[model samples]
Target: MYGIDVITLVSYDQVQHTDEGMLSLSYWTIVGAYTVRGEKNDTGTMVDAVLYDIPSRKMLFRAPGTSRIKGSSTLVNLSEQLRTDSLNGFHLAADNLVTNLQLELDRFRKKVKAMPESYAIEHQPGYTGGGSLEARYALTLLVIGGFALWSSRRKEGFRDKF
Candidate 1:
């Protein structure tokens, strides 16, 4: 089959973070237009195609532009060529996308590795509930004192006297 040879792929992009927990793996496809000229024709119509991929960055399908060649010997067979060229573009796009994703994941891994496994808490209860009675009594007294102050402030409208 004789058809146009056009190749295209998605462009480079940054690692996107979305409001949802998961990040977005969005992609935009690029298409090249070519004129499928026959052995005797001076010019051929332009053909364009856009391909789509799944979330896993695998090609799902493609949507091609209109074809404007209808003749016995015009060599206007474009479906096969479109498929071939589009596949090539898809591979290139996938490779680039994977490289970028790997770089991003590496950064994340490094950050996680640098983080501390356990963080220290300034004040916490004992593991076996064996806290000192004096500390517990102090906490209760503090709570009661705070409540009294809060009640007094509420009764006075928390404002200066006129």
Candidate 2:
């Protein structure tokens, strides 16, 4: 009942640690020495959205988005930091996916207009397709109608005078 024409499927794929590095700090004094160590993690996420024709089961297009996040965390909080970074990466990638989807939609519209035979375009029952008249065309029609009305009135005035 919703009149759905196309279906979109989204997935998050290719998630991995794109980069890793070691972080270390050391301080030495006359009495003793202290050292700290940590790990730097870089996570990457890819989001893909595919649009398909429900009836034909044909793929219209695929839009892909990617994001990378780098952060340093102590060994005790490594897992928590990585989880936060992964969530952030997905959010950023999803945002980019939306932008890509819009661009793909515009491209698809232009393609359909350029080559109408490739796909079928239809409107649901009780829905009528319409086009708008340009401002100049409407203004010209209004001027012509007004002049015709004025001329008719002027001619009637001359007939009454005679």
lDDT digits (tens) for residues 1-162 of candidate 1: 232122334343212111211111121112111222332211122233333332235332332322222221112334454444444445545554456556655764565467645222233334444454677899999999999999999879856655
**Clashing residue pairs in candidate 1, if any?**
none
Q: Global lDDT for candidate 1? A: 0.40
TM-score per prediction, in order, is 0.27, 0.62
Pairs with steric clashes in candidate 2: none
Instruction: Give one digit per residue, the lDDT tens place, for model 2 in 1-162.
Output: 577778989888645452334343321332211223256678889999999988788999899989988777655566787889899999999999989989998999999999999988787786645745678999999999999999999999999999
Q: Which regions in candidate 1 have their CA more than 4 angstroms from the true location? A: 1-75, 116-162
Residue 159 CA error for candidate 1 (Å)? Answer: 99
For model 2, the stretches where C-alpha displacement exceeds 4 angstroms are: 1-5, 18-37, 126-162
- Using TM-score as the measure, the top candidate is 2
Candidate 1: residue 10 lDDT (0-100): 35
Candidate that would win on lDDT: 2
Candidate no. 1 TM-score = 0.27
Superposed Cα deviation of residue 48, candidate 1 (Å): 23
